[model samples]
Target: ASRCAKVRSSDVAVLELERPGSNARHRISEEIARAISEDKAEAIVLGCAGMADLAHSLSEEHGVPVLDGVVCAVTLAESLFKVGLKTSKIGGYAAPRGKRFAGMFAPLSPAG
Candidate 1:
């Protein structure tokens, strides 16, 4: 979503796959290839952090520029924090470590 937000409206098209968990490399690469072949996209920005890890391979496979939001976000965040910044403390936003869950996929956690 941030990728979509970062891009200029007149410049690029954003396409998302249904299940990013299943085929990280192939799905993004195929979509990018299609975009390159059809829409004449000059670059493909990876939409997921997982896809970010695959950014290099995807760029090579598609022969186009590939970007990872993680890298860019981290750089921006670090710069902000370094310049004396702090996050809001009044909102619903908080650390995930102390959160409780009541959902279809309860207590979700990352897989190593």
Candidate 2:
């Protein structure tokens, strides 16, 4: 995809040997190893949402933390909620202070 977008940089690496349309664990793991070694990375972050299920196994295989963005988001939300670190109606979530509006969106003024 990046290639098709004309992205040319040493910072990017692509695994061209993997079978097309296949995101199997082994194939992903192979690519992860390549990226880690080629980029001298400390960890692997699964790039696709479909790879979320393989995060644990891949992490174990590579001896590094494999991160899935979806899982990270959910985990962060849960942790914050558990710690009562969320928006509150009495504070940040409170309605905006009085303000005027004009034109088509005039009715959306805080005064309204």
User: What are the models' TM-scores?
Assistant: 0.48, 0.57
lDDT by residue for model 2 (6-86), tens: 212222224432346544556667777776677665677666566677789889888888889888989999999899896
- Per-residue lDDT, model 1, residue 81, is 91
Q: What is the C-alpha lDDT of each candidate?
A: 0.63, 0.67
lDDT of 2: 0.67
Q: What is the C-alpha RMSD of each candidate to the true structure, in Å?
A: 13.2, 8.1
Quote model 2's TM-score.
0.57
Which candidate has the highest TM-score of all? 2
Tell me the number of clashing residue pairs for each predicted model: 0, 0
